[model samples]
Target: MTTQTDLIQYLLRLGDSALIQGQRLCQWCGRAPALEEELALMNVGLDLVGQARNWLDYAAELLDDGRDADHLAFRRDERAYRNLLLVEQPNGDYAVTMLKQFFYDAWHLEVLQGLSRSSDERIAGIAAKAVKEATYHLRRSGEWVERLGDGTEESHQRMLDAIPLLWRFTIELISGDDSETRLHAAGLVPDAAQIASAWQARVEQVFTRATLPLPAAPSYFYLDARRGLHSEHLGTLLAEMQFLPRAYPDATW
Candidate 1:
């Protein structure tokens, strides 16, 4: 059986991943190389932020501590965030950002698909709604991966370099903890191992279409974000994300 603490932690992890990745995506606002791509990135960022709000609000309800989504999102310290390291990595370039999104969106689609059938009704509902959005995200990122991978000699090279760099971070997406194991046993969550297979298949299909070679797996670097350990990039991200909230302190816009 999954404890309330475990559930709350799990929800927070979900929220944090979306929130931080949304923030990272938003950095590309008005800066994308093309107008269409700029709007696409912005739209996806908003979708992720919307998902983050729902998950964070649900997490607050589970905690029953009087805090709201905003508190858990913008007011939390770096060590309090449960997001994985990949989401917090600096958006190096367009290729880097798109590669990151491609990897994450593939994993997210599989996870959300499984969650859509969860025994927990609330989780199932959220997953059902989120999977639709995630599907669009995957499509958009996949399109870009193909364009960049098969375009020009320079574009293909950049995309190729991004593959190995981003692949290193892909392992943890389907890696689970004791809480995940219990949830799986209870039918409240999908088996991480199963989700990994789906993720792998999806990735392989996309890579084949893009004509990009898959990189061999590297030594896994585990960061215990569930226990509040985070990458250094998170501090800068938090400082910017929390600046307005910290300055305004309860004042509404």
Candidate 2:
């Protein structure tokens, strides 16, 4: 593929994951365990949504197919989404939510940090801005993981239960495909191995503090989100998220 195509795909991967994950976090607006936590979650979700706009905006600019960021975000079918499988999974209990957040934050920070130094000025600028938000996200999620994992037996076990449910999808977190390889070659993105290594180290450090055992890395699932194959949950999510735009195609905000 051309460098332009690769970059667009990479941006969509970044943007779609942030959009979906942000939407998932917003689901906790009224349901978070505490008031302060609810506010924090919402703020983080907003941060991610803002980051998604930055990415999708750039992707739309490059595509230049008459679709703006809103159209790219809301008008796409599930088969067109390039988000990571980990981000699209349904949020379960608090433990499940935090652990999932921690995992994604870990990888997200690494990828953002790497992109912050991109040879492409636009990508570097966007990543520079995003890295700050991702850093706080990782720290907050990491602390939560430690708190719940080392807390009461029930909370700890909930984290344990969360492991098997989320762990398998993590393979996609570190696994880079051809588009990423092309970007890496062009210095538009970071080395996938380095990002994977850093991601694993962060996960290990947080899990060690949380007193949770890290499981063996599992094989990729039959479906891959980077290739537009997502879990069934994505369709349900898109229905809710896209309803407004689809229903009012000519309405202006």
Candidate 3:
């Protein structure tokens, strides 16, 4: 059975991933290499944050907790966050950030597509709405990956370097465990293995177009952020993202 705990945990995982990644992308607010790219990134970040709000709101409802999306997103400590390690990793360079987005957006699009068909009405509803946004993110990142990878030699090398550095974190996105197993059996979620196939196909297509060689898989590093363990970067990210609200403490506009 998909217990309430399982449902809440699952939703929190989704929310945390979007929230953290969106925050990371927002750091490029005024820093993108070009004005057009800056606007694109900001638009993508807003989409992710919007998706995060929906998932977090659902999670809060499931928990019967009064905590809103702001509280869940900003008020939590590092260890309390359920985001993947990849999303929290520092945005090293343009190539690195683009690669990270490419990897994440591709997988997330598949996940959202799968979830859109979930038997759980709430999950399906959120996924139905989110999949459209995720699709655009995937397309934008894919285009950038291709441009960088097929551009100058320096850009190609930088993108190639990013592949190995970030590839290790990709495994967790499609690997299911007890929580997923329970959800799958209860029709509350889709099989991770299925999502993996779609993710791999999409990634391979983008990489091929980018003229980038895929990195060999790395040794698995299992950090279950769903259980609240997070990368060191998450602390700093939360501090900055939450600064305004934390300083004001529920002050309204």
- Global lDDT scores for all candidate models: 0.86, 0.94, 0.86
Tens-digit per-residue lDDT, 1-253, candidate 3? 3488888888888999998899889999889999998999888989999999999999888778778887898788888788877888888899999999988998899889889999988889999998898988998899989999999999999998888878888877767778888888888888988988888888889889989986665456756676776767788888888898889986998
Assess the local accuracy of residue 155 in candidate 3 as a C-alpha lDDT between 0 and 100.
97
Q: By TM-score, who's the top model here?
A: 2
lDDT of 2 at 7: 91
TM-score, cand. 2 vs. native = 0.99
User: Candidates ranked by TM-score, best first?
Assistant: 2, 1, 3
Residue 214 of model 2 has an lDDT of: 86
Cα lDDT for residue 173, candidate 1: 77
Which prediction has more favorable TM-score, 2 or 3? 2
Compared with the true structure, model 1 gives a TM-score of 0.96
Q: Which stretches of candidate 1 lie over 4 Å from their true place?
A: none
TM-score of each: 0.96, 0.99, 0.95
Ranking by lDDT: 2, 1, 3
**Residues 138-197 of candidate 1: C-alpha lDDT, one tens digit per residue:** 999988888888889998999988877667667677577798888788888789899888
Query: Among these predicted structures, which one has the highest lDDT?
Result: 2
